[model samples]
Target: MQTSEYLTNFSAGIAPIPQDQWQALAQHCGPFLQYSFLNGLETCGCVGGTTGWQPHFITVHRHGTLVGAMPGYLKSDSYGEYVFDHSWANAYHHHGLNYYPKWISAVPFTPVTGPRMLIHPNADKQIIVEKLLEQAGRLEQFGASSCHLLFAQDFERHNACHAGYRARWSVQFQWHNYDYTDFDGFLSALTSRKRKDIRKSRQFLQASGICIERRGDGQIRPQDMAFFLSCYQQTYLKRSGHTGYLNQEFFEHLLKTLKNRLMLVIARQGDVPVASALFLYDDKGLYGRYWGSLRDVNGLHFECCYFQGIEFAIENRIPLFNPGTQGEHKILRGFEPIYCCSLHRLFASEFDAAVGEFLDREAPVITNYYHQAHNVLPFNATFRAQLISSPENKKGHF
Candidate 1:
């Protein structure tokens, strides 16, 4: 076993971790794992200081070499974690046990999952995962009642189970690119009925004179970002009576530092931008992060958020498109349901078995729902056959 000293080094922030070292570990993970993106969250006041998200980043090093890292927080509340655990917290409350200050590793306010536990390519991954869990559990000493790893990658779920943490599964709708050449090619792969439905939606928007376009890489201008933030906040205010978790400075900070990975799909009505969505992409995937609008036009949301992302993914050859979370509407539009995982280890022995039992009961129902959701995908027979035979389905991806 690797020495415990080589693991469990926690810092209050990611700012001190050398950028090059962090990027080397994050390179294949995705753009959200980039040092700039993580640090931008802190530096821009989106997190830290009374946000209930106290940054508690972890890095493992061996002989002065960075080996692994995870985005962690000492969460006082569970508002931002998409892996809902409010019921668990309430359970603790009923029993007069504290659930606040649970340690978690996840990207803040971003539900489109990729990776949370980041490891260097050359490192002993199995060893790192083991030690990481040890350290997370050890946070109990700092008053953490439990440890949670949210939206972790699938293989990490297996590792966590082996390490004695109970695995919890949730489903999210995501799109998979199967070598399409363009938007029309993508539509061609869909069932005739669904294809016509999507086509009509597009035509309705096009005929309404709502122009949709995408800007990415260096083309996302400052004004474009400002417009997106306003729409984003406006929508949040209408729904929740507050601006979204991310602030204007956070947007600006990411724009300056991580703009290359950023994308904007803007919908305009005759030269006036009315709606927009923001995405983060790398060579691996296109992640739809946020979308908002000044005007709600017929079919505009689907055209801007889903159809545009599908087209971009096809053009860019990005193999996956995860358009945020919890939208069954996406299933009818070709997005398929897949399992997302979270791991929990409550320090209280009594609660541990209860939570474990709860998770076990929930897993099959969630998995069954995942399998059943496949029936509704808009794919044609050929595409459906391709999906059934695909290695992802065969592996079951849990």
Candidate 2:
């Protein structure tokens, strides 16, 4: 398809694409691009401007058939995006420019990396990307200083780099499920000290009389949500000046509709709930979304958020656990440095060139950082191999 005919802006003409095509796109692109998943983000009201997320989704059609789509936004501020550009915003401010109302293509709030440019099966990805750039070229009219595509897949990341999207890399700790028949098999691969430490952590949770429960869908009571929010609030308060981006309704809606894909790990003491971690999963992996605790307990966060999720993944056979982003702490718990990707398209030539140069300088540092983080893994080479080996993880399957 010619790029022009293939592209259309839907700022005011946003129409619901048929479910079949949406699912087909996801299946063709694989699980991370699932329709139910993206649609759920919209249906839950998380992506609309009422919550500071304004969807400006872009689509491509070939011969009147849906072929590609990019879930984008006219972001007024940079809150939900895991990739940070506050420096650029600051620079723009110092130069008397406004950086708000920029364009972004990403999954809101969730930073787990997969596909960002949703391409249909057999579609010309190059054309899709060109059309995207063409639309992004017009970002200045929307008062956007630049357009950013976060956590794009490797191919799209490279393509964007070549097409003038400055590339930036960040390290996120991810637990890859090696083929382990069970949790014990996983622990057996750890070094004696790390293994013992994890075991003792679990023991402490038990000794503290903490009971962990997994709740899904309608089974999540109002009290569960309330407790989770309390823990979540406490997390922000600890950070002085931290303001939460979401409200209770968001979780309520997620629990109601995305339940099968939602997993809530709640820790309770006697009759009181203390800590909770919220995770979302599909066929490919488990995404640990939020974790909060009202009271501090030694190793409690580790046990609840990392270890328990790993056990669950092993039991259910989920392949990976992206326990949120930016956690060096996760590395000690067996998470590896997986590079999350993003792309940028600045509108003004001089600004674009400047940002492009800035990204070139930054990308290597980001790359080197991930490489350095890799050397700090908690296991010996042999144990690391066992942890990454497929059969070891599938055996314990979540």
* Model 1 weakest 10-residue run by lDDT: 389-398
Count: clashes, candidate 1? 0
The Cα local distance difference test for each model comes to 0.86, 0.75
User: TM per model?
Assistant: 0.95, 0.87
How well is each residue in 1-398 modelled by candidate 2, as lDDT tens digits? 44556645554213377777666566644333566556656765656746667878777777777777777788888988889998888888898888888988887787877777777778887887777667667778878888898888888787777877777777788888767799888887777888888888888889998988987534677677778887886887786446365566667766665667777889988778889988877668888878888888888888778888898889889898888888678877788888777788777677778887887798889888877877776675676565367463542311
Which residue runs does candidate 2 get wrong by more than 4 Å? 1-7, 12-20, 27-45, 216-223, 237-243, 384-398
Error of 1 at 64 (Å): 2.7
TM-score for predicted model 2 compared with the true structure: 0.87
- Candidate 1 residue spans exceeding 4 A from truth: 1-7, 386-398
Pairs with steric clashes in candidate 1: none
Q: How do the residues 68-161 of candidate 1 rate in per-residue lDDT, one tens digit apiece?
A: 8878999999988888888889999999989998999888998766677888898888878776777777798999998888888877788888
Top candidate on TM-score is 1
**lDDT, residue 393, candidate 2:** 56
